[model samples]
Target: MFGPEGPSLRELAVQALSSVERGYDLLAPKFDRTPFRTPDSVLESVAKALAPLGPFADGLDLCCGTGAGAQVLTGLCRHSVTGVDFSAGMLDVARHRVRPTGGPEVAWVRGDARALPLRAAFDLVVSFGAFGHFLPRELPGLFTEVHSVLRPGGRFAFPVLAPPRPTRTGYWMLLGFDTVMRVRNALWRPPFVMYYRAFRLGTVLDELERAGFGVGLHALPEFGRRDDGSPRARLVVARRTQPAAGNVNS
Candidate 1:
């Protein structure tokens, strides 16, 4: 649900019909006000989870919309932090909104996630609420890019919630949303690739390992656990154990 300052119903409708880039551009000004933005609680939890891994020198926030993750990185990283996104409009807002208070120097860059623009330059990489934009097949390339940009032993971390069970209303809602998105993409051009159900945890872990990361899952105590006793949410902390041999570092 959106706040009063968030996008209107008409505005959301128009955005849904546009290309992903343009839609985000149109939504950028009010993005932080929307439910779409990563919540402060999630960000705080991630920062706490990643803190022990740091005092990292430099950090990159992949698909860093509105700079929420980048702000988290500033606290953990010591030198510099960069927030990259394909949307220049989002980058512009991030530039103005996420200033370095006492941590690393922060900067914003406009770039596609699939083809990021830096080499083995970062010690830590983080992303929040952006994976739904990528399809299953793109995971290899995406993880490869993240691997290439990270120094050996560096981490690529993000939070993942355990999917809701079939009996839960949340499960039905996500299924319905993905079903709608599939139908929309089947009919529309320049598909706005946002599907809540496509990013499976098992598949992602395999891909991360294949892309040369030594993957691990860290339980985030904030969200607690499900009835099954598995943590409700966890941080996937994939360490770049080796260089991505065949992958070009953008």
Candidate 2:
């Protein structure tokens, strides 16, 4: 699903061998041409869903690549928008892409997601197309980091697609991809951590709860429903817990 301007097969091979940051830096110029960038359609759907919740003061885009999610934050937030990622290359691209908007000021920080540097600073946090880089065991730490950055009553939002059922060919496709990734990582260096199957919804919700967020799912009916009428995708909204002593905002 790569565009004509995307990386060539040789470039892909070179990137696959380097570490994540360097690989992304080399790919930064061509990333949007690939299927990896979150589409504007998803961004529009999310913006519509979050708009009514509105008028947030600050927003954070976790693992924001090319600042696609940050653009959505511009609609929901009024004060400032920040995007943090460990990849310097990705951050560079993001900074450039969102530069001329001049509507909502943007900041790009280079840091690992597990130990984010902010403390209760953001009113809204969002991420897109980057979760697969994290392993299952890393979810708790990742969620904790996100929680630590959010102010009381602030939200962490992201979209999740429904898992494929046994009857679906998509199920087997994802299964095969994950299996190959496991095998590849077992033998490769500077392991690429993107896997289609590692982040299950139940486990993710449990981790968010443990990290002190009150969670809810907002079904995104745009993608339609399954045979049983379950939503094909949903936006997970987890609001940061206020102190047990009192309601900080009130």
Candidate 3:
């Protein structure tokens, strides 16, 4: 649900009808006011989980929209922090709004996650709340791109919540949202590709391994657990295993 300052129903409808990039462009100015932006609690939890593993030199925030996750990177990394997103409008909003407080020099790059422009660069990489835009079939290329940009022993980290049970209201909400998105994409050109259920952890872990990453999952205690005692949320840290061209330490 959106707030008083958030996009109206008509604005949301127009955005849904447009391409993902264009829709985000239209929505960028008010995105933080909407429920679509990653929450501060999640960002703080990730920053805490990453703290012991870091003191990193350079970091990247993949699919960085309004740069919330990039702000998290500034606290964790020491040298430079870069936020990359395909939406120029979103990057413009990010550039103007999120200010880093001296931990690192922050920069914004407009680019696709499937084909990143850099190579063997970052010591840590983080993404927040943007994976649903990529379909299941695109995972391999996307993961590979992340691996390519990270230096050897560098990490690719993101938070993933456990799927809601069928009996829960959240389950039906996600299901209905995905169904509507499917129908909308079927009838639209330059299809908007947001789907709630497309990114599965099992499949994603497999893809990360195939992309030369040694993956690990760290439970985030802040969100608590399910009835089965499984963690409610986790941070997936995928480390690049192959040796880099230079003997650079991460």
Q: Number of the top candidate by TM-score? A: 1
In candidate 2, the residue pairs with backbone N, CA or C atoms under 3 Å apart (3 or more residues apart, or in different chains) clash, namely none
- Candidate 2: which stretches are off by over 4 Å? 100-102, 243-250
> How well is each residue in 97-145 modelled by candidate 1, as lDDT tens digits?
8987877888888899999988789999999999999999999999998
lDDT of 2 by residue, 50-71 (tens): 8888779999999987889987
Worst 10 residues of 3 by lDDT: 241-250
> Against the correct fold, how does model 1 do in TM-score?
0.97
lDDT of 3 by residue, 81-164 (tens): 999999998999999887877568999999999999877789999999999999999998898888888887899999999999
List TM-scores for all candidates, in order: 0.97, 0.94, 0.96
Better of 1 and 2 by lDDT: 1
